[model samples]
Target: MHILKKGLVILFGSILLSIGINFFLVPFELLDGGIIGVGLIIKYLTGMKPGLAIIFLSIPIFALAWFYNKSYFYNSLFGMLFSSFVIDLLSFSRGYIQLQIPPVVSSVFGGIFVGLGIGIMLRYETSTGGTDLLAQFLSKIFKINVGIMIFIIDALVICLGGLLISKESFFLSSLTITVVALFTSLCTWNDERTKLKTS
Candidate 1:
């Protein structure tokens, strides 16, 4: 039952994340953060599939997780696989729905869904791997806040995307990342408070 619950959480979270990416962010050329953002940029540049890019790009991170953190590896492995798979499977959305709304609005909604998805996974004690795991490892070694590392990594990716894509993409992508970070933080705030009370 416990395992099943975890599986469901991963499935739902991945679906939400994919929806935000395909339906909102991708259509507008906006971006989230971390490796997911990188995958999108790869797709934007090379005509490659974002999901395929994600799966391929994730290899090194998961490899590191395998050696350094068995628990994180097992927790994130399936989430990563399913999320990538779903993102590819949902590619039909590229032509199915194209909204002519403002980029800022799309960025906000995109961030909400993406952040909510990730936050749920994290709250459930799992994640989609990628930079989140890398952040954890780096934080352990450097004694810096994982959140800060993640933000930096995200900013780098978005900046690169902007350079390669467009100034508008860069600016809107920055907004998307900010919104995602804010919502993700909100989702985990309760968890932090609970942990504090328990500790």
Candidate 2:
């Protein structure tokens, strides 16, 4: 029952995350950090599918996971696969999703949706993998907030994306990541507090 609930949460979260990417960010050429950012970069440069790009980029990391520990890989695989599929499906069928918000507004709202999506998945002990998994590990090791760690990693990816994209992307994407970090932190804090009380 718990597993089923978790799976549903991840599924719901993935839908919102994909919407944030396709409906809000993609039209603006804005990027989110991590594998999603990499996928967008690939999409911009090669016109390939971002979902496929994400899966391909994740392969090496997932393959490497098998040599050390399989638990993390198993935990992440479902969330990653489902999210990637949803992203591609939405991107392909994006004719239905139209929002003409300004770039900054899109970034802010997109970040909130994406952050909440990711936060819920992470709270459930699953994630879309790549930097998210790395952020989780680093958070445990460094005893820092997972959201802050994710923000640091995302900053690097966005900077790289800016070099490949544009100056406008560099600045606005920073705002996007900051809000992502802020909202993710808030969610994580709330989830942890709830857990502490329940436990």
Candidate 3:
């Protein structure tokens, strides 16, 4: 029952993420930060699928989660897999529905959807891995806030994406990531510290 609940959360979260990416971001060639951004760059360069790239790229991140935090690994593994699958599934629906809006509106709304998906996963004590594991590890070692760590790593990824891709992609991606960061931070703040007290 617990497993099913978590799986459902990840499933819905992945759907939202896929909607943000395929319907909004991908059609515009807009990049996002973190592993997704890296995968996008790889796809742009190699004509490979982003979902496949995500699965391939997540291995190392899952490995890190395995070694650093077993709970995190177990929680995130299925979430990552299911999210990747959903992304691929929804990618096919790209032609059916698209924003056709301006880049700025798309970026903002796309970020909201992406962040909400991630927040739902995190709220359920699961993750989609990638820089999530990195941020967790850094938080453990550096005593920094987990959200802050994630933001920093995302910023670095955006910067590298800028240098690797075009400056326009970098700028748009940064906007997307910034909104995602803000929403995720707001959603996850103090979420884990609350507990029920039995009388």
Candidate 4:
């Protein structure tokens, strides 16, 4: 029953992520951070599918997880694969998901949806891997806060993406990541509260 519940959560999360990417970000060439940002950069440059690029890019990170953190490897592998597949499967929706809202509105909503998806999965102790997984590993080794590492990585990705894509993308992506961080924090706040009470 627990495994089934986790599977369902992962599926739901993946759907939300795909919707955000296809419906909101793609329209304006906006970006999110982490591996997703890298994937988008590749997609924008080579016209390749972001999902495919994500999978290819994650191979080395996943390999490291397999060797050093088998538990993380198991937890994130399915989530990553499923999410990547869903993102690619929904890629066609970009053409049909036209919204009349401003680009800022789109970026905000996109961040919300993406953050909700990621946060929900994280609450269940699962994730779509990529840099999130890498951040965890590095945090363990360096005794740094995982959140800080993730922020640094995300910031770098956004900056790189902005430089390569456009100035507008850089600014909008900055807003998007901020919103994503807010919603993700909200979603996971209960866990932190529980830990605080216990500790």
TM-scores for all candidates? 0.91, 0.93, 0.91, 0.92
Model 3 C-alpha lDDT per residue in residues 164-192, reported as the tens digit of each score: 77788788888898888777767676663
For model 4, the stretches where C-alpha displacement exceeds 4 angstroms are 138-149, 196-199
lDDT of 1 by residue, 1-199 (tens): 9999999999999998988898889888888789899999998888799888888899999999999889989999899888889888888866867777787898888888888888788778787889876876785577554455666788999999999999999998888887777766676667756765786
lDDT of 2 by residue, 78-152 (tens): 999999999999997678768878999999988988998898888888889878877887886786789999999
lDDT of candidates 1 onward, in order: 0.83, 0.87, 0.79, 0.85
Candidate 3 residue 42 Cα shift, in angstroms, is: 1.0
For candidate 1, the TM-score is: 0.91
Q: Model 3 — which ten-residue stretch has the worst lDDT?
A: 190-199
Candidate 2 overall Cα lDDT vs. reference? Answer: 0.87
Model 2 misplaced regions, further than 4 Å: 192-199
RMSD from true fold, candidate 2: 2.0
Higher-ranked by TM-score: 3 or 4: 4
- The candidate that achieves the highest TM-score relative to the unseen native structure: 2
Candidate 3 wrong stretches, greater than 4 Å? 192-199
